[model samples]
Target: MDLAQVKKLMLRHDGCVALKANTWSESTFTALQPLPVEQRGAYCVLKTVELVYLLCSVHPLPI
Candidate 1:
């Protein structure tokens, strides 16, 4: 999928997801699914031998 499609899908998700981050990659994209309310605004941390990655969300937290 393209950025526009990803952005659109993320926008439709109901949760507090990250809209921006320091970097991005294909792995940064989470599986499209319903997130729990408590898990909203949560950031996914992926650790590898060479690098540690963070995955953000498209859903914005309430102001």
Candidate 2:
């Protein structure tokens, strides 16, 4: 899958999910299945001893 495929799929889903609870746990995660390796997003849910979540998209960035 490519960004075009991802963006196409997002069009089916409402572009974003409602930010329910604003928290993540041992069970909650976002998994875009049946996708090719290229269309995947980056994740950094853990940083050493801390848990960090972002409301950001990674297809493009200043970095």
Candidate 3:
């Protein structure tokens, strides 16, 4: 996902556009660092991975 798409998904989670509360916090700072500088969209891509691991449910919710 692009940065815009990542931000859009984040809107569903507490309206958090960025990964962390403070600029210098760990996750926020990590997301700012691309896995590889030459890799295209690596920043957003990294965020996408984190979002999946952190937010995605492991089991189906009962309705």
TM-score of each: 0.22, 0.27, 0.30
Model 2 vs truth, CA RMSD? 14.6
Highest lDDT against the true fold, candidate: 3
Output the lDDT of residue 16, model 1.
Answer: 34
Question: What residue runs in model 1 are displaced by over 4 Å at the alpha carbon?
Answer: 15-63
RMSD vs true structure, all candidates: 13.8, 14.6, 8.2
- The 10-residue segment of model 2 with minimum total lDDT is 47-56
lDDT for each candidate structure: 0.37, 0.38, 0.52
Order of models, best lDDT first: 3, 2, 1
Top TM-score hit:
3
Tens digits of per-residue lDDT for model 1 on 5-54?
Answer: 44554567653344444334333444313556555345343222112111
Clashes of each: 2, 0, 0
TM-score of 1: 0.22
Residue-level lDDT of model 2, residues 1-63, one tens digit each, is 245644554566678434345334323344435445565443332421132113233432121
Candidate 1 lowest-lDDT run of ten: 46-55
> Can you write out model 3's per-residue Cα lDDT over 1-63, one digit (the tens) per residue?
255544556686666544435433456557567656675476667655765544444531121
